[model samples]
Target: MARLPRLSVTDLPHLVLWQGHNRHAVFADDDDRQAFLALLTDAAAREGVELHAYALLDVSLWLLVTPRRVGALPRLMQGVGRTYVRRFNQRHGRTGTLWEGRYRATVLAPQELLAALVFLDHQPVRAGLASAPEDWAWSSHRHYAGAASLRALHAPAAWWGLGDTPFAREAAYRQRVHDGLPPEHERRLHEAAVKGWPLGDAQFLAALEAQTGRRARPARPGRPRKGGSKSVPKLS
Candidate 1:
């Protein structure tokens, strides 16, 4: 069977979430997380891309990026990915690929965007790293919340549709994240963000189509599951 192709910005205007191979925890500590973000900065310099805002999780990273040029996206990814993996291997004393597969992306609308950002920020809480998203300190939450960007992230206000005033956008961002997942929607709690994969709502997605003018292709048929395969993700 064929597999659903990994979502790409080329095909959709989205909020991207992706992670390392086998759900491995590549971002160990603060330094590690910051280091990875720095790679994103370098990638931006090389690729001519603008990364609006992003969040760093234990095993993955969520990014909001747009390429300025049409053909530069792949080269941009290759440059950053290769450099990041190289550093990750050296620091951890490990060898081999650090990523699981291509990053998974999903189209999202502005109204639902706040939710997506919150989902990314709250990863640590979900992953058992901290009690709340703000407590983690490694995410781009600060950048959005009006803190001076760490330079590597290249966080810009325009990314979030925040206009010229940085303070207003920051206040709005904080409020949105502080709001949490709507009242008692526990079933969909983890669905929005599953291991760096962000899924959006049908209504908002329709709006997103209008705003970005990008259409998502249908999901491809994936490979058959092996009988008694030991690898399985436990559904919480």
Candidate 2:
């Protein structure tokens, strides 16, 4: 079996997880992270995708992006990859593709939107780069908190309409994400990791079910490993 090329899909949001080639450290250090962001911001300006959340760790990074145009994701991703790799190779005396290959992406529903936001923001902590998410400098956390100006990463002000102003809304969102998550929300994190589906309100589940044509269950069978139970035969 061969890996299929990234099928060009219509305008759909995806949760992407792209690792460095050979599991090598793509962001070797601070300089590497800055270089990557610079390229990313530039490319993002040309694409319509909204980079809602992200975290720049020491090795790999995470992102929560929604493509605004169909068939443009690959080109936009390639643009950032090429720009960063070119600089990375010149600086480190290396060459070749920096990325592993076509990135892993899962089309998601808005129901899972908040979970994705928290995960992307907390990637640094989860990866052991920092004790807290806000400590990491190279991330959209500050942007969301209204501390920094983010022109490329488009997290609209209206999303948080409760605030007296757009800046206030950003601040509120930051506090919600930064303040240690509630127990139920913490549990939600565990569920998202295993289920890979949005866990939220009943209405959200209904919407997801409609789109996927499958009811959202608490948990499903996970990927199989060898030297375990007998393989379940497929029903034809």
Candidate 3:
């Protein structure tokens, strides 16, 4: 079956995941990671995408972004992927596709923004690459924690709502990451991105459906009866 187009809406936060081909290491060293970030900074700027949070794992990378207009997300990803692949090939003395396939992405409601950010920050830790989020130098954790300044990074409105002062906000964000997300919530976020489903409640999904003219959530399991049922499958 043909795949559904990536669900992207302007001005909404999106969680994206891109993996290396066959689970190989995408970033061989700090230099490769730095190069990828530089390329990402350029592509995101050119495509008008606002970077919220990110984690660059050895075999995969996660990103939280908000596109300023329609088609901005894919354009940004495509531009970075193409250029990065060329440079990585030359640097590593290898060839062919660098990515597993197309990137996976899911649109998120405003309410889920902070949760998604936490999710991105904890990826390296969850993967056993680091003991703490802050130890992962390639992620946005340090930026949010005020340990580093990334020029391309943009804090979402929810982040601002964390506290009135910069230090307060940073402390609050650090605390949130320290608290960690529930396993179920993390699973939901991962599944949503992999399936390209919109992550939100009924009202939010309904509004998104109206805006996009497509199903915002998955259809119910089992066949429909003679009379239609009002129930929809809950996101697992």
Best by lDDT: 3
Q: Candidate 1 has which clashing residue pairs, if any?
A: 2-221, 2-222, 17-196, 20-100, 21-99, 21-100
Ranking by TM-score: 3, 2, 1
lDDT of 3 by residue, 1-236 (tens): 57777888999999999999999999999999999999998888888999998999999999999999889999999999999999999999998999989999999999999999999999999889999999999999999888999878999899999999999999999999999999999999999998999999888999998899878877656775768775765543
lDDT of 2 by residue, 3-77 (tens): 333433344455666678887888888888878877777666677777776677765667767777765667778
Predicted structure 3: clash tally = 0
* Top model number, TM-score: 3
Cα distance off (Å), candidate 2, residue 126: 1.6
Which lDDT tens digits does candidate 1 get at residues 1-236?
A: 45544434442335666677898986877888778777777777777776656777878777766566654456666777888788888888999988876765554434454555666677677778778766778766776676656565544333447655767777877877788776444234344333323346665445544554543323334543777555433222
What global local distance difference test value does model 1 have?
A: 0.62
**Residue 25 accuracy (lDDT) in model 1:** 83
What is the lDDT for 130 in model 2? 77
* Candidate 2 stretches greater than 4 Å from native: 1-12, 156-158, 180-236
